[model samples]
Structure formats: structure tokens, C-alpha cells
Target: MTKHIIETVTFRLKDGVKPADFAKSATAMNAYVSGCTGFIARRLSYNADGLWIEHIEWQDMDAAKAAAAGIGAPEGNRPFLSAIDGPTVTMTHTELEVSVN
Candidate 1:
């Protein structure tokens, strides 16, 4: 059976970066990823500790891996990358095993 893939990235904004700027970059990043093959959905959220989390859903592992290669391209990701504190970023990928909702 085909399994869904969840790609999560957690990071903090670079020093002196404004939330508005990050939002704009994120919106562009979302729009770009939405056009890739097997793209499902994506959401960006933050916690009180000032760390942001991006949750992206893909049709399967293959799709996620394929898209990962282009994540740092200048097309729509440069601004987003510029806003992030690179050293603080952490990413992981997982296959959906079960879902209640």
C-alpha cells in the first residue's frame, strides 16, 4: 500500500528578522511546493519559545525525497532560507502509520 509522508522542519527566525517578512516567504514557499508532484498539504506554525514548525504532507516518500532536492533553490526558497537561523534548523520525515482524524 502507498503510505503518506510527513515532512517536518523546526527552526528559529534569524536575528532581526520580522514576522511579516517570514510570512511572505513562507507563503511563497507553500505556493511553490503546492505545484510539485504528489504534493498534499502544508502548514506553518510557531510556539511561545520562538521556534517555527512547518508541516508538509506528501503523497509518499518518493515524492518527498524528490522535492527535497529543490528545497534550497532560488526560485521561491531563498527568502525563506534567508529568514531562518540555519544552525537551529532540524528536519525529519516519517510515514503515516495511523490517523484518527
Candidate 2:
């Protein structure tokens, strides 16, 4: 069954780097993630901890993994990676118990 995957990526901006300089690349990455086949929905957010959390919904776990493998540099994620001090990416699968919509 289709499920939601919350992929959180933490980016510690370089000593003199600002999130603004990397916004475009982040946006591009998100656009690619949201446009992939089997993508149902997505949301990206920033936290005071200096990490970006991207929640993505895919048709299934297999689809999610396939899409994630494609989420690296080839998709233009190189800039984002270069602009960060330290970054970590992880994905979590969520089972919905109930939904109003």
C-alpha cells in the first residue's frame, strides 16, 4: 500500500554560509522529489537545529527507495551538499491509522 516517508536531512551550514545561498538548490531538489513517479505529496521545513525535514509520500516503500537513490548529485544535489558543513539524510516510513481527508 502507498505510505508516507519522512526524509529528514540535516545541514550544518558552513561558517560563513547562509541558507539563502543554498535555497535554490534545495528547491530544485524538492521539486525533483515531488515530481517523481508515484509521488503523492511532499513538504519541506527548516528547524532551529539547522536541519531540513522533507516529508514525502510515495506509492510504496520500493518506490520511495528507488526515488531516494536518484536523490543524489546527478539530480543537482551537489550544490546543496557542497554548501553544507555537515549533513545527514534519513528516511522513515509512517503507517496511517486514520485520516479525515
Superposed on all Cα atoms, the candidates' RMSDs to the truth, in angstroms, are 1.4, 2.9
lDDT of 2: 0.66
lDDT of 1 by residue, 1-101 (tens): 88899999999998899888899989988767998899988989998888999988999988998888878875678988888998999999999787665
Clash pairs (backbone) in predicted model 2 = none
Q: CA lDDT of each candidate?
A: 0.88, 0.66
What TM-score does each of the candidates earn? 0.90, 0.69
- Give the number of colliding residue pairs in candidate 2: 0
The TM-score between candidate 1 and the true structure equals: 0.90
- Angstrom error of the Cα, residue 62, model 1: value is 1.3
Q: Write the per-residue lDDT of candidate 2 for residues 2-63, one digit (tens) a residue.
A: 44554444446666767677777777677677768778776666777677666676777777
Clashing pairs in 1: none
